[model samples]
Target: MASSDLVRRIVLLVVLCVSGGAMAQTGQDTSLVERGRYLATAADCVACHTTDPAKPFAGGVSIPTPFGQIVAPNITPDPDTGIGKWTDEEFYRAMHEGVGRNGENLYPAFPYDAFTKLSREDVLAIKAYLFSLPAMSQDNPVSELGFPFNQRWILSGWKLLNLRKGEMKPEPAQDDAWNRGAYLVEALAHCGTCHTPRDFSMGSDESRKFGGGAVGSWQAYNITPDPVSGIGDWSDDELVEYMRTGMVAGKGGAAGGMGEAVEHSLSKLPEQDLRDIVTYLRAQKPVRDPADEKPRHGWGAPSEDVSAFRGDETGDDPDGRAIFYGACSSCHGMAGAGTDDGEFPPLFRNTVVGARQANNLVMAILEGVHRTVDGETVSMEAFEHKLTSAEVAAVSNYVLKTYGNPAGATVDAAMVDELRRNAGEQPLVAKLAMPGLIIGVIVILALVFWLLTRRRRRSLR
Candidate 1:
């Protein structure tokens, strides 16, 4: 019980207490950053912002719109080109108000309208994670929109009609899980941006929410709860599986934009979140387009004609059956049935083949699929150069009639040729020509006004 011993023990206890406090603070900081990372993943910011695999978030992705192509800008911590110089307030305004650092309106292609529903804390967390990344000095390409479409002011008008600013309030009737799913799907995921048809001003058509819309050549299929046209028949498990792996046996696989979403975003999400998305989707009001009488995979029965394997070639033009034997029979069987393992899905009861529009099927034939699920690489070779447009049309027709909806058998060589020529091109509105005409008329009016003023001055003199 010496006085010296008591003093030494007291000093040691004080030192330990300070060290423990410091460690706890460090842990909190790490947790915040990790939370931010998870939020960014849920938001799927990397899909649009990161064009190159090597340069993640150093954005240069080309998003095509009816107006033109708008390249995504860098979001890296680079002070000059990226948002490194952005204040927290500036970043919030951009996300919540769809305004830039200089107070300019951002194109809806950025999906800020949906992002506006994000809470301030969530938006800041995303910013925090983005700032933590390595800065790249890459400058994004300028947008190629013509005339009035290129004008940023036009977006102000568009926003007044479409943009709904404010965080989503939970519905009193719904449970916490349902509300969470709704927020994630409608706000963060912005599924309506693609699935909902556009109005005259290019805003999403709320009346047909998740009832399907066209994105370039690809159709974002109806996801409403309609038994025939939408996903009402899809089991919860099937929906979750499709979101996770981008495929469901006897149904279909993802391609194009949906394919990209699966590869980059959906596949990377947690299983629970995927289930939540399905929950929200299932609760949607059933909407059916009159054109769709049944589910996409519920059409035509499989056919097995022996003439196809015999190379009969009886038709005036080369039949699709003969072409299938020569080119496609190797991977896909003579009967159009794929591998037993479901690595290559069977042609019958396939989503893509049975879709109301044959655009996806045609494009798949021309471009082919090359996506990786889990660790395995799933690929289908492109036949654009190998097969003539006529041959493609014939084979596509045969597959549609034999293994899919006969109504979808309307594709011709001319349609194939046009699809080939405009392969990677954006869908431009026919009204693009009208913009140039308007500008010309305005210029002529200005000149006429000037001439009249000059004549008046001369008369006065």
Candidate 2:
């Protein structure tokens, strides 16, 4: 071949190799972004960050806290209103140290204490996935917090008390699956943020890990292996099925935060990952409360009140049995034995009904069950508008007596009224905050009145 022809051939080979290398790099980037998206789902990031399904991660969701409502910040790639300008280092810091890009302290509500355990690579992968999304430019509203909480500077002191910054280390004795489960549970899932109770300063009580905590308007049930109060008797399959679909035959259903986690996160996760989580939970130290009773799913039998509905259709008296015939009987059956396939789960042997605390059950009645698994949405219509509070209480008591834990059958209209306030109480901080604010206002008015009198006397002179 001529020298020019040989040179042309060599140049063509170099161009093809370069093209192949670029294509390989793009493939890797796509894979990383996909992995990050999975991790984001596992983290249930959408639960707090996105209010509207159409504009995910744009972060205008309002999270109710004892202090006040905490608004989720935008994590989308909008340079103006989102974290688009954030460097990988800044993102990692937010995850690992509970610190924001501008070095502001993030509230514990974000659960950075758990994110702190995530590996640097995992954190960056999550960031990569977040950045890959369409840059949403919606502005996040300021968190509606009370005095001390609104003062971001106070959060620094909170961090010192609660934050534990570091990556999770694998336990050598455990097998790979167990270790994987541990990582997913302790870090990515951040289950402790909901399962573990908070201390006085509102930090998760690590000592009481998985002992069950309260979320907005719902109780995060005890997941510890205690036989009475927790899931000790729950078989691995039961736990897995419940986590995967928010429903397991004769066990319980997930509602509130748990329902969201199931629909958006757990149900979509790889099966092995879920099995690993169950393994880790099983291995944790069992925690039991002194007031513990039988397992939540171990309560009740078929309602004998079946006889009440058997008679002539009762007059429009809105008592528990009357309401059950009218509203509940169509799905749950007259015997309270739910549908054959467990589509409509039996109120008996169910957590919401059998739980010692009536909060979750009442909330469910008012708000109703809504969870999606495998792209199918399962929902129960909410009765907040349809039923009076007294009617809710009556039906709740009847369900508890006939089909659930008789111990928890003590619900009343007054208790239902309280639960109607969205299932949470004012935090100690907010409870104290309002009174202190009132006192401060009174003192300021007194000072102003004294000053006005002094000015009047001077004018008279």
Instruction: State which candidate has the highest lDDT.
Output: 2
285 Cα displacement, candidate 2 (Å): 0.9
Candidate 1, number of clashes: 0
The TM-scores of all predictions, comma-separated, are 0.88, 0.90
lDDT of 2 by residue, 319-341 (tens): 78778878888888888888998
lDDT, candidate 2, residue 339? 91
For candidate 1, lDDT tens digit of each residue in 1-461? Answer: 99999999999999999999999987876777787787777777888899888899999988766666788999999999999999999999999889999999998888888888888888888888888889999998987776767889878888899999998788999987788889888888888877988776677888888888877667789999888998889999999899888889889899878887888778888888888888888888888879877788997665677777666545578688888777777777767788888778888888888887788898888888877879877788889899998899988988888888878888889888867643233333436547667888999999999999999999999
Record all residue pairs in model 2 with backbone atoms less than 3 Å apart, i.e. clashing.
Answer: 217-423
Clashes (backbone N, CA, C under 3 Å), per candidate, total: 0, 1
Pairing residues by index, what is the TM-score of model 1? 0.88
Which window of ten consecutive residues has the lowest lDDT sum in model 1?
421-430
